[model samples]
Target: MVLYQIYPRSFADSDGDGAGDLQGVIDRVGYLELLGVDGVWLSPIMRSPGADHGYDVSDPRDVDPLFGDVDTLRHLVEALHAARMVLIMDLVPNHTSVEHPWFDAALAAGPGSPERERYFFRDGLGEDGSQPPNNWPSVFGGPAWTRVTEPDGTPGQWYLHLFAPEQPDLDWSHPDVGDDLDETLRFWLDLGVDGFRIDVAHGLAKPDDLADLPDDVEIAQLVVDQRDARWDRPGVHDVHRRIRAVVDEYPGAATFGEVWVGPVDRFARYLRPDELHFAFHFALTGAPFEAGAVREAIDSTLEASRIAGSAPTWALSNHDVVREVTRYGNGTLGTARARAMLLVELALPGITFLYEGSELGLPSDYSIPHDRLTDPTWERSGHAEMGRDHCRVPIPWEGSRPPYGFSTSDHTWLPMPASWGCLTVEAQIEDPESTLSLYRAAIETRRAWPGPRSASVEWYGAPSGCLAFRRDDGVVCALNTSDRSVPLPRGEVLLSSGPLPSGPLASESPTGGVLPPDTAVWLRPH
Candidate 1:
């Protein structure tokens, strides 16, 4: 499926409240249809206190006023359905906002109560319960355990928060936890949500002992290393199987996990037939701009999905990482490379998730002043990490100045770059040479290509610093990573990420086309 990810607060604002609501998405359904996406994968929109930008859900069954009411969400589903598209809700089963009623009751119920049992509450490790229970650090950069003061005003048990202090990790081992999440799944499924994207799917289950991690583990390794104490435990697969059982109850409804595991076999475990329909394997997301890195990422991801007997997922950038345009080097050069990568990503088999503003080639606004930063990581990390706010800036949809039609308000939730006028969607819509146009053309072409019966890709021999792969259907994708031009494979050019070279496409060579440095092309065998 060609799914588009919309970060609600930053997409578009209909009430002029400086935050995007469900109505904004409804109004933009036409745009999504034109872009050829099969569906939308909306980020968290449930009841929240705005911590972690809705990831800290206070109520999983209701809509947040910050976005809209239940009726608004229903209308959004209707709109997308009318356009022959579906809605995949983001579900956070790992933790809950400290403001949640369960958490409040857990705090007031004191130690050993059933309420406290729903979360990871334990006595401190030191004399008089003075120190934290364990050394596991929060993903945001501090000790994971937070000691709570009892009603009598003495420091009592410590609760674990793998993320921020305001997000308490739920005890998946608790029976009530599974029952509540099952109810949540049904609640949205009944409301017309087609599927779910489980947030932190690898993090829901943990070791029973609550063991201490080694000193060398860093927060970044949480997504990379399967050995990290806080992630990828064997228990998580059982959790997925439980969720899959519920999703299977409703025909046509599917679920995918945000699993951060390693190697093909290890990653494939989460996608066993009894578990998730698919698990987002992030090999491609972390790849660099070079051809070799990109090839390895794709090969590994394909192998993993093949082992799982499921479809693969391709994503270049997402809410948490620096935008691809900026990662490839930020400028005219960066934009060119980003375009090349997108073409390469799109030409591959399987589902593709296009992040918001990617078609307009919006680079992450690293210039967002430190004072305006709002991601919890900024404070939790003691300002050492700037966090993801730079990538979460409001979309520049139209107009030439600030806000760029994202909101009518003078100030948005995050500061948008004034220099983005030229990158606005309105500026790129009709310009055939613009990045938006390239996306439209590419998506349309990809949808039309009748891929091979077997989805596997066959690698074509290519020169140094270049890579070429052919599908069994005779469609070939070539990318040039060297500083010089290279001959394209023997095929008719279907689409290219950039302008082709002048002078007969270097006809003197056996091949019929010249691929410029940092460019990619899709072709049908001649």
Candidate 2:
């Protein structure tokens, strides 16, 4: 099934509050239905302190006022279902905002409080009272531990936060914690959401004994804590099985997990039948724009699915990474290359996630002034020397309107890129050759031909600046990565990203015809 990702704040502002809300999403249900996506995955909309956007949730059952209340969310979900679309909400169970009542109660009750054990808290002070129990650093920068004062006027202990200091990691080992999560899942499932996209799903469990990182490592020490404990723990599968049982009680329900790791083998484990229905393969999205590399990634993912006996999901851009267009487009790549990339991703096996702005062929804008930056990552790690604000920019909807129809108000949470005015949904919808139309066409084509249960794919030529492949359905795809035309053999063109040249294919030829640079062609073999 085709899935669309909506970054709530940047999607559309129905109330013109300068920030998108559930009502705004409900208003755009027709837009998504018309776009031909079967499902939509919204970023977190739960109650939070906005520490890491909505990822740092304070209440699991309530909706964040920034997005809307519970009633508005229910209406949005109903609208999507009425349009024959599924709605998937983000589930951030890894941590909670420090402002959450549970955390506050834990801090106030000291070590003896029953709720205190629900979180990771240390007793006694470090050599310096301000120091943490271990040398772990926060993912956002600084020490992972934040000191909390005790009620008795004593120096309080520090707590561990894998991400920002305000987001403290949950103690999954606690029995009550698991029960709380199970109840949370049921709460949403009863609300009629199709499923949940579990944030950091692999991070539910951690090593019992906290450890320190190597002295020479330059990356944040928090990485060590996460890698060493939370991710891919054997115990995590049990937790998944329990959650799966809960989801199974509801028909047509599913789960997707965000398992970020370099090894595809480890990532695939999260997709076991009893575990997550699917987990994102970030490796393919992170690969360079090389044909061989792309082929290798695709093949590896397919192989991993076979080994794991589970379906996989593919993604190019999300709230977490740089945009696909900005990553691959260098001003010279042209729209042809971008379209080819889309075809590659769509043709791959399993579910596909389309980020909000990718259909418009929008590239990330790196011109955000320092003062305009809202991403916490920008302020921490010095922007990681890899600006992410570009991908997080507000989406452009109306071509001529100021802020590109993202917001009617004078100011937005994040500045809209200047280039958005000319590249918007309203502008492209009317243009037959526009990327917006192409995306709609592509989605329709995929819907029409779901492909064989097991489609065989073969490479027919070298991947030197150009690549050619044949699918099981007698469809041949030829892509030219350079600017020059590439010769092709005789074949009837089925689809093309750009203008097609006049030609007829023979049974066999000594050499193929030339293809225009950055262009792609799908043909039927003679």
Candidate 3:
């Protein structure tokens, strides 16, 4: 099934609040239905302080006012189902906002309090009240722990925060934590959501005995201390199995996990019959955009999925990474190269995540002024390269409107790129040669050419240059990786990034024609 990812704040603003909301998303369900995708994966919309956008959730069951109320969210879900599309909510279980009731209560309870036990609170006293429990850095930057005063008017112990200081890591070791999570899942499942996209699913558990980083590993120490406590611990399987049981109670519901590390084989662990149904395989998204690298990633993912007895999910871009167009689309390579990458992703086995604006071939806007930056990574890392705000700019819907239909007012949470006026939905929808039109055709072709889910891929040329691959459907995908094209063998061209050649060829000489760079073609035996 085809999947679309919607970064809520940047999608569409129906109320024109300058920030996208649930109602705005509901208004666009028709657009998604028309695009022919089976489902949409929404980024987190739960109650949060917006510290890390919506990932740092304070309340799991309630909708944030910034997005909308619970009623608005429920209505959006209903609208999605009515349009014959599934809705998947982002589930951030690894951590919670420090403002969350649970965390606040834990902090107030102080040391020796049962509520504090629910979190990772280490007593700072050494043999004579002199040292910390362990040295660990936060994922954002600096020390993972922060001191606070307890309600008892005493110097409180420090608490662990893997991400931002405001986002306290949850104590999965506590049984009550699982119960709370299950209740939250049941709350959403009862609302008829198709499934959940679990965030940092591999990082649900940590070693019970918190350990310091090895003294010899400088990088590991600089970053967060390698904590075996959280992430891929054997105990996490229990939590997944339990969640799976809850999901099974509601047939047709599914679970996808965000697993960041481990081999493909290890990734499959999350997809155990009793756990998640699929986990995102990000190997290709990070690999160099070359045919050989692409082939190896695809083949390895397939093999790993096969061994795990589960299917894999592929994603090229998301809220966290740079836009695929800018990442892989060298402006000089022309549209052909862009289309070739699309073909490879579409033709590969398993579910494909189409990030919002990806269909319109939107490029990342890196012109954010220093003063307007919103991403915490930029401030915390003191490095502009670490932030992802460029890729998270508002989508361009209106051709001439300032902010490109994202906002009518002078200000928006993030400014729409200046190029959005030229690269917008309205302009592209009317042009037959537009990227949006090509994407539509590609989606339709993929659905029409249903083949074995376990199809094997065979690479046929140099990794960086022109390449060919045979799909299970018997169609050969020939792609010219360079700006110039090499001659094609005998075949009828089914589709091409550019116009079709003049003559029907039996066996043409190896004529080096101009490919306009980065173009792709689908061919079938004449």
Candidate 4:
């Protein structure tokens, strides 16, 4: 299945507030249908303090006022269903905003209170409890523990937050936390949501001891560390099993996880038959635009998922990462590589996730003013990493200038580039060779392929800096990642990301296909 992910805040805005809302998503169902996606997965829209952009949920059961009220979300769900589309909400169960009622209760009922037990509230280390319980640093670059002022108006216990201070990690060991999440899942399922995309899925179950990090260990290393990291613990699988039980009650429901654990075998555990249906294969997301590296990522990702009896989920750009077009290097070369990689990603045998604006080949805005940067990484890293705000800018939809008909007001939550006039949907819909058109053509062709659905990839011998794979259906997808043209596989051309080399050889070649540099083509063996 091809799932289109919409970062709701930057997708579109119905009201002149410069922020995307439920009405904005409702208005775009037609566009999603035109894009030919099987379903739409929305990022967090739950009530939040906006500390980690909605990841820090203040309420799991209600929609944020910034996005819309509960009624508006219901309307959006109905609209999507009416269009034969499914809606998947992002579930952030690992943490909650510091302002969340439970967290607030924990703070008020402090010092050995039961409410404090619901989270990782521990006494500080050292005499008088001044130091943190451990040396673990936050993913955003500061100390993971934050000292809280007690209700008695004195220095008090410290709380753990793996991401931001505002996003306090929940005590999954506490049964109530799991029970509450079950209710949250059923609340949305009853309201007609098809499934959920679990955020930070691997980080739910923390080490029981909460021991200090080793001297040489870094928080960043924890992401790829399969050994005794705070994430991807054995207990996390049990949590997923319980969530899967709730999802199983609703027939046809799905669960996708955002798991970044490494050593493919360990990462695959999240997708065991009783856990998540699939987890995002982020290896490809970080892979540079090189054939060998991408092929290796695809192979390892598929193999691991296969062992776990789960489908692999492929994605390129997302709200957290720099946009693919810009990531490939940035200008003509970047756009071309992005287009080529999209074909490779789609042709792979698995569920694919298309980030919003990827079809338009949007570029991240590196020029976002320093003051406007909201990602905690910027401040946590002491202004070293600009963070992901650049990719979160509102997309251009129509018209000639900034906002480009995306919102009533010229202002947007994140500024759009003036040069985006040419990439608007209105302009690209008519241009057959535009990135949007290529996406439409590829999706239509892929949907029509009379192939057996398989989660396995069959690699074909190919030239250096090139990759060719035969899908289970005998459709050969080839990509040339080099700076020169490459021979096309002997097959009938189905769709090409770009034009083939122009010559008699191109004509005499199988189905007149000769892959140009940084181009990909889907072929049907004749």
Better of 1 and 2 by lDDT: 1
**Stronger candidate by lDDT (1 vs 3):** 1
Location of the lowest summed lDDT over 10 successive residues in candidate 2: 502-511
Q: Rate residue 477 of model 1 by lDDT.
A: 92
Per residue, candidate 1 scores C-alpha lDDT tens digits across 490-513 of 778899999887445577545656
TM-score of each: 0.98, 0.92, 0.92, 0.97
| lDDT tens readout by residue for model 2, 1-526 | 8899999988888777888888888888888987899989999999988978898889999999998899898898899998999999999888899889889899888877888888888764556576677776666766678888888887778788877787888888888778988899998889889999998887777677766655554443222333454356778888888889888899999998887654666766777778888777676787667776777777777766776777667888898777777678644363556777787777665789999988988887457777877777666667654435678777888857557777788577777766566678889888988888888987887777646465336878744777777767666777767545657644876667767553342123323444566677777777
59-160 per-residue lDDT for model 3 (tens digits): 999999988898998898889888888999999988899889988888777788888877788766575433556766665666667776778787668777
What lDDT is reached at residue 120 by model 3?
A: 81
Model 4 CA RMSD to the hidden true structure, in angstroms? 1.4
TM-score of 1: 0.98
Error of 3 at 383 (Å): 4.5
Angstrom error of the Cα, residue 281, model 3: value is 0.5
Point out where model 3 deviates above 4 Å: 125-132, 152-154, 215-230, 329-336, 383-386, 461-464, 498-516
lDDT of each: 0.89, 0.77, 0.76, 0.88
Ranking by TM-score: 1, 4, 2, 3
In candidate 2, how many Å is residue 100 off? Answer: 1.3
